[model samples]
Target: MTVGPAEARRLSWAQVRARRLAWHGLAEPLKGAGPADVASAMAGTHAQMMSAAELGIALRMDGATRADVREAVWGEHSLIKTFGPRGTVHLLPARELPMWVGALSALPRPSSPHADGVRMAPEQSEQVIAAVGDALRDAELTIDELTEEVVARTGPWAGDLVMPAFQGMWPRWRQSMHEAGIRGLLCFGAGRGRKVTYTSPRRFLPGFAAEEPEAALRGVVRSYLRAYGPSTPQRFAHWLNAPATWASELFASLEAELERVEVEGVDAPQWLAPDASASAFAVPRPRDVAADVPRGVRLLPYFDVYAYRVGNQPPALLYPGRASERVLRGNFQVLLVDGEVAGLWHQRRSGRRIEVTVEPLAPLSRARRSALDDQVARVGEILEARPTLTIGEVTVGGHA
Candidate 1:
C-alpha cells in the first residue's frame, strides 16, 4: 500500500500518536538509549513537538541532569536569547541550536526594562570566563562552588554581578562554543549530601565542531521534521516560539530535503520526510483484545513532550476551556494506550509505597479500562517494591 505524501501528511490524530509512540518505544525508553540519545531521538521523532523537559522526564532525569542534556544538545546553558513566544527558557537540542538562537535573536528586543540594576559589561564577562576556565580546567564544580569561586576572585561585586554578566554575554558565549564545536553540559553530579545540585557545563564527549550557520540550521530543521513531520509550519513556528517569517525562511532553506503535502480534507499544507512513502501510513492499530494490550506504564515527568508536540491541541481536545488553566497549574502524567493519551494519572508516595491515581479524560469502555489496569500493573512491576498502585480512579467529566 503506497501512501502518497498528501495522505501521509493527513494522518488521523491516532496515527500521529502511534507513529510518535513507536519512535519513543512508547511504553518504555528504548534499551541502551541514554538521556542524550533519548532526547535526541524524541526531538528527531516529533520534530518540533517535544520540549527539553518532556524528553528529560521520559528518560527519568533530574533537574541537574536535564540541564546537562540541554547544554549537550543546544551548546548553551540558558534558554534566554531573543524574547518572543513565551519568554521562558527552552532546552534546545544541539544540532538545531544555531537556527533557534538565530531565529529568536532576529526578533525585537523585549521592553521588560532589563531587570533593574543588574548589568554585566564585557570586561566582567571576561573575568567570569577566566574564572570558569580555571574551575573547569581540571575538573567540574557544582554551580554553587563555581559561583563561589567567581565571587571570591572578582570580589563582592562579582558575587551579585556574575550571573547577570553570564546572562548578558550568553549569546556570545554560546556562539563561540558552537563555532569551536565545544558542547557544554555533559554530565550531572549529586549535590553535597542529599541536596539537589544544578547541572554544570563540561567537556564530556568529543566530536562536535562549529559549522556554517546555514548548514547547522538545515541539519536542525531536517532533524525536526524527521521526528515530528506531517505537521504544519504554524505548528512548527509555535513549537519553536519563533515568528512565522523566520519559520518560513527556515522551511525554505530545507525545501530540498522535505516534501510538502495537503491531507485529504485539510486545507493547510504540512511537511514530512521526502522518503516517507505510503508504507509510512501503516501506523500500528489500537489493540482490541485485553490480553494483547501492551504492558508498562510510563511515569512521564512534568512537561513531557507528548503534550507539547501538538502545540496545545491535546488540551483543546481533552480539557477544552481548561487547557491553559490546568496545564499551567497542574503536573499531569497522562496514561498512554497504544500511543494515544488514554487518561490522566497522578502519583502520591508515602514512605516506601507510591500510589498511582488515574483519571480518564474520556469514558473508557471495558476493554480500554482493562488495558489501562495492565499498564498500571506494569508500572508497579518496574518500580519493584518501591511503587505500588494504591488507588485507581476512573473519572468521566471530572468524577472518578
Candidate 2:
C-alpha cells in the first residue's frame, strides 16, 4: 500500500515495543549465538565503554559472558574493535567490517573545531589516516606510539596540530583516528598495563577488502531498517551521524524497497522495510501476566544501541516524564521491562559483590518486580560476582 503521510498506520506504543523487542533479539534470549552474532544482530554493540558493550552483548544471549567477548576478540578473531556510529568504539563482526568501513568512510567529516589556521585540512587528515594504517600493519601500538609514527610518516604538521576542546587543548590529529577506523586501518587492541593500544583491523581479518562506498552504504541503510526501522530519514541521519539533507537524499534512493507506516500516536509518518509484517502495527492488548518480563527484561548499559536508537520518540509513551533531556542527551543505562524503559539502574563493585540499585519511574506489578530480581541474577551470573539488589524510590528525570 502507498501510505502517504496522512494515511500512515498509527503504531501504538505497545506495538512499537513489541516490534523493537523482537528485532533486538530480546523477545527471547538468543540461544547458541556467539558474541559476534550479538554484534551483528544489533548492527553493533555500543563499545564507547567496553564493559557496557560486553554486557550489552551478553544480555541478549542465554549464557554468554565477558570471557566470551574476550575470546572472540582476543582469541577466536571473530570480532573486531573499531569506531562506528557517532564515532564511538564498537565491537563489530570481523566479516562485516568492510561494509561498515565503506559506509562510515563515505560520511562527510565534521568541520575541525580548532582555529581555522590550526586545524588539519581534509587532505592532511587523509594523510594521517593512511599513515596510521601503514604504521599498525600486523602490529599494535599505544596512542603515543601511534601518534609518533603518524608524525613520522605524515610530516611534522601532524604533531603540531591541536584544538581547543572543553576548555582544554585537544590533539587535532586524533580526530583522524575515527577516520582511520572507518577506513579499516585502526582498531582498539588489548592494552599494555594501563595504556590504551591501537591495531589494524587486518590483525583480526587479514586482507579485508572494502565495498565501494555507495553499495556498502545501501547495505548499511538496509541493516538499520531491519534492526530499528519503522523510522524516519532524520532518525537515520542521527544514527549515522550524517547530515540530514544527505541522509534524506540517500533514504529517498531506497524508496522502492521501503513502505510508510504509522507509529501510532506519533504525528510524523515512519517508514519500514518492504518485508516488514503487518503484525508489527497491530494494536497490542495489555497482558495480565508478565509477558515481556520472562524473556525480555534486561539491564541494558548506558548508550546501549536499543535505547539510543529509540530515544527520539515521545517520552510519555515509554517512561512518562522519566527521561530528562540530559539523560537522553548523555545516554544513560536503563532498566528495560516489557520492551519499554521501566527505570534506571546503577552498579558498583563492592569487594566481590556487585551492588545494584534500581529506581523505577512508576510502580511495577508483583510479577514485574520478581522479573527485575531475575534480571539482577542474570547480571550477577555474567559478572561472576554475588549481587545485592537495593530498590530505590521511583524518581523522575534523575541521573543514575
CA RMSD for every model? 8.7, 4.7
CA lDDT, every prediction? 0.45, 0.73
Flag clash pairs in model 2: 9-262, 10-264, 11-262, 11-263, 11-264, 302-333
TM-score between candidate 2 and the true structure: 0.88
lDDT of 1: 0.45
Report the lDDT tens digits of candidate 2 across residue range 1-400: 4556666555566666766676566766555678887777677777777788778778877787787888898788788888998887888888788899989988976666666767677799888888998999978999888889988998877876466558766555787788788788899888799998999878777688888999899878877766676678888888877898998899888776766776666776677664323322221221221134323567878678353354236655565456543244545668777766667788888777998888777787898888889989988888878998999943434334
Estimate, for each residue in 161-264, the C-alpha lDDT of model 1 and write its tens digit.
Answer: 32234335322222111211122322233335754233333342234333455665565555456556556666777765556777787776666677664433
What would the TM-scores of all predictions be?
Answer: 0.62, 0.88
